[model samples]
Target: MTVATDTPLVDTHFHLYTRDMPITSWAWHHPPEDASAEQFLALMDQHGVGYGVVAAASLYGQYNDYVIRCCRKYPRLRGTAFVRPDTDMYTLERMKADGIVGIRLFFRRVPDPPDLNSPEYKLLLRRVRDLDWHVHTLVSSPALPEVIRAVEEAGVKLVIDHFGKPDERLGVDCPGFKALLAAVERGRTWVKLSAGFRMPSREAARSYAQALLRVSGGERLMWGSDWPFAAFESGVTYGQTIADLHDWVPDAATRRLITADTPMRLYFGA
Candidate 1:
């Protein structure tokens, strides 16, 4: 698996956790996994990834020292936080200064969005918007349309995880998946073509990813590892997952756009 010199892979999602934070009861499927900052950098070197966004996994709650430590260790990498609604704007500004790009809802583990439209959460989102940060969601595919509409209307860019978590049970044409396709056309919404194993099947993931590329126009799409490749563990390595993306979005240019160009433009202003 050789990556083209110009290919420029950017892993949009990965995790690091510290034990001092109370374990989230919601992350039951994947047993706790640990990877030091150096180990993660070495993994990227081995796989030819130029950059990786260390998204805060739910298990770490709001204690973000491990991820902050990672960014300090590797200035090339950026991070996102799992924040509480009451967190003040200054703290969020501090995180942005520390290479934090956005806040993640981690919606898969916590499906409900805590009413971002409510007075309190709305204020939180508004503060986040003022900083030019994005809101990343791990919502299921079926619920994406509503979530996307709400987030976009709130005036923030959205990053949807796992190809909208398309229900292989219902197939790609499912209303929710179609809704995601339509949403991507709006430009404010972006989707990560990561976690093939979590999809019902590789074939389904391929179909879903190709469909996304067609409508997303490459600019609104990004790639991720979802590394440690949690829950669906079948001895797959991060490299293999990176390699598998060729099957999902075949056009070499679109591949570059999704894996490198789009993420660079959105996350790093490259």
Candidate 2:
């Protein structure tokens, strides 16, 4: 399952968190060790990853100072930040100028997910669209329909985190996954083949990955290491995550599309 390609690989999703950073809220247990940008970049170099996108962690809530700083410090890195719905356009502009390409909506463990149909939320989406930014979403299967409709209506490019997080028991046939496939077909949406460990089982992960490839093709798909592995860190390693991509997508050409070509277009605008 080795892929030989000249195009540099880009990890489309990862996070950078330091203990010193303020934690306004957390989804689960706080990471035992700091996953600094320096450590993340070193992992990328060690694994030959050329560039990466630093997804804003939910633990840090609306505090994006660390992620913004990393994007400014590292020329090869881009970032997404967590911003409140009432976040000023001028402040968003400042974040954009600092190398933030998107904003994250964390719906998984948060007590209250924003109401997409609300005026403020819709206005935020409009601003994001105007700024030429995408929305990175993390939600469970049941929440996908509302998320998809809102994002589509807003006409914003969307990136779904963690394979659309379909229910493990239902696999690709899950209603939410079906909606995701349709969204991919409509264009302006991309899915990350990442955090496979988050899926219920390896078999379910493989099924969902293959279904995405069959329905949406490699052009709309991307790969990510989910570096530092979050809650699964003790069991999942960077090398293992990269290898999982090889197992899920065995074709070298398609692998190139996911690992380098598509990500370059999506994150680096190459």
Index of the highest-lDDT prediction? 2
Lowest summed lDDT across 10 adjacent residues in model 1 is found at 1-10
Over 54-86, each residue of candidate 1 has an lDDT whose tens digit, in order, gives 877876567787787678667888989878888
* Model 1 ranges off by over 4 Å: 1-8, 18-21, 30-32, 111-113
Instruction: Check candidate 1 and list the clashing pairs.
Output: none
Badly placed stretches (over 4 Å) of model 2 are: 1-8
Error (Å) of candidate 1 at residue 121 is: 1.2
Provide the lowest-lDDT 10-residue window in model 2.
Answer: 1-10
Every model's TM-score: 0.92, 0.96
Which residue pairs clash within candidate 2?
none
